[model samples]
Structures are given as C-alpha cells and as structure tokens.
Target: MESDNKQPCQTALYEEEETLARLTKTANFQGASGINQQSLNFRKDQMCDSPAERILKQLHNKQLLIVNPKRRNGIILYKRYHAEFAGPGSAVGVSLDTDCQKILPVGNLDLISPESADDRQRAYLIRRQWVRLTLQITENPEPIGRAQKIIEQFEGFFDSATIAKLPDEAFSLLVGVLPHTVAKVRGKR
Candidate 1:
C-alpha cells in the first residue's frame, strides 16, 4: 500500500539525518585545524582512551614515522604555549620528549614503520633529522645564537623559498626565540 511505502521512506530519511548529524558532531569536535580540543578538555581519569593518548603511546613505544614527501605529511606537536613542525623526511613518535604535548597530524600522514624502509631510507634515518637537530641547536648559550643557528640549520636543508613559506612562530617555538628574532635572522640571509 502507499502508506507502507511512505512509512519506509520517512524512516530512511530520518536515519540519513541522524547519520549526518553524527558526522557533523565529529567534524565539529575535531575542528578544521586537526587538533582534538575535546580530548584536550578531558582529564586523564575521565577519559578511557583518546586519539591523543594513542599518539603519545606510540611515541613511548619508539615507533618512528617518516613524513610522506608526496603528500607533504607535516605534523605539528604542540603544547599549550609552544609548537614545532615535523616536515617531510623528518621522523616522529621517536622521542619521549613529546610526552607532554599533543600531536596534530596536519594532513593524512602516510606513516611506514622503519622495517618497511629500504637501504637509502635507512641511511637517511641514521642522520640526525629535523626535530632532533632543532632540539640540539636550541641549546645554544646565547638567545641570538639560538635564533641564528636554527635559521642556518633550516637553510642547509631547505631552499630559501621553501624556508620562507614556513611560519616564523614554528621556528621560534623550537628554539625559544622570539618570532621577530627569527624574522631578523631570516632578513640577514
């Protein structure tokens, strides 16, 4: 009967609306920037498991992730007051230093385990990559030295145009330098 068909159609439309509302809620919770503010808001006791906790657990497990160059799989590990960019060719989830921070994978990170790496990639991993190198250089005694050295190190790896594209705030956060100091150093180049 027509009534039976109409009832089914109404049920289908209602289900579709519920599904859409759930998706929208998830999207709103995650946000456009990719950081899960919802997870950040919850205390350890209140939340059983979260995406952020999983990332920290992976870091603690010493699982290394290489940023996929083709996708520009960039990640920003940030605390409430600081942030650092881990770009392509950089390793993540390797250092325990990220324990207190949140990992925001900017785009879909094509992460592969080290066991999957070939000989060339293995050799590349042997060298001190971006995050490690940044931490080391930022230990400089003088503030100006910290800023200049980070800029210099980045220049050695990335071309001027590429380096120019990165935000000054990221560079400054890694080295404990002011954003203006990074600008001054970049201007000198």
Candidate 2:
C-alpha cells in the first residue's frame, strides 16, 4: 500500500524538479519558429500582448508564424521585428558596449550602418513602435550641414542624437533630442 503512494510522490517530485530547472536555466524560451537562440518570430504589426505562458505554449506546439512582408516604398502604419524573445539575451553575446562596431536589433533585425534600404526599413520599424532598438553614432560625422542632411533623411523614423563638434567636450547629444537639443547646444556655444 505504501509503495503505491510512493510511486505518485516520486512522479510529482520529478515534475517539480523539471519545472524548476527550466525556469532557472533560461529567462525566456526558444520556439521552433523563432531564431535558434530566442523566442518565436513576430510580425511588424502584430500586437504583442500575449502572456509568457501562452507564448511558451505556442512555441511548444509550434503555432507561431514569422512574416516577412514585401517592402513598401515608404514608412507605413504597420511594421515590426521578426520576433520577441522575453529573456536576457546574453546567449547572443548581446549588450556589448563599444565605439568601434555596434549591432542593435531594430525590430529583431541586425543594423550595422544606416545606409541601405533595409537599414531604413529597420529604422521605420522603430518609428512605428514595432520594435525597440539602441543605435550608436560612432563615426565622426562629416561637416555639420552635410551630416545633418544625411541624418535628416531618417527623420520621423527614429529618435537619435547628433554629436556636435563645438570643442566644448560635449560630444554626446541627449537621446531623442534631435532638433531641439541640437539648437540649444549650438546656442550655448
């Protein structure tokens, strides 16, 4: 009689251990439809309000879909990254801080330099609130006029800072302080 009870007890304990191990080992999950190291891919316009458990269940059952729509000529109402992984992305060697090269996910897509159509699209993704990103303006920009002109092309798409060359040692502009702060800092000089 005791042996019969022991079997169920052991099974329950085993289940508990498995759950604990999974939670402790990783912050988020990796679904079959997501990148090899992250969660399932999300579209550019899909609202992301699902609970973690629901997302995990979707991943487990392979019910997620990754959408890569054909690019439009201009920014639009809908745009997002390829996926949303709810975990500390340390596995991808992420969160690196450096001045040479920085790769931030502008909607789960990698952005090196804001020079191509794809890069522009990624910027649009951020503009549409489809994804989150952190970009570094490392290159010493050209003369103020030309550089501002270049950056202007990307205006209304994303918020970024302009590094002023006032020789005041104020090399960094506040994030999202594009036109306003730029004028103020220049006025200070």
> What TM-score, over all chains together, does every model reach?
0.46, 0.19
What's the distance in Å from true for residue 162, model 2? 12
Question: Compared with the true structure, what per-residue lDDT tens digits does model 2 show for residues 1-189?
Answer: 223322211221334346544643443543323333322223211223322222222224432112122211111111122122111111111221111121222221211223455644544444433223212332334334423432443343333431222222221221223444445445653
- Write down the lDDT of every candidate, Cα atoms only: 0.57, 0.27
- Judge candidate 2 at residue 165 and give its lDDT: 23
What TM-score does prediction 1 earn? 0.46
Model 1 lDDT at residue 60: 62
Q: What is the lDDT of residue 87 in candidate 2?
A: 14
Off by over 4 Å in 1: 1-64, 69-76, 85-90, 94-132
Question: How far off is residue 144 in model 2, in Å?
Answer: 1.9
Question: Candidate 1 — which pairs collide?
Answer: none
> TM-score of model 2 relative to the true fold?
0.19
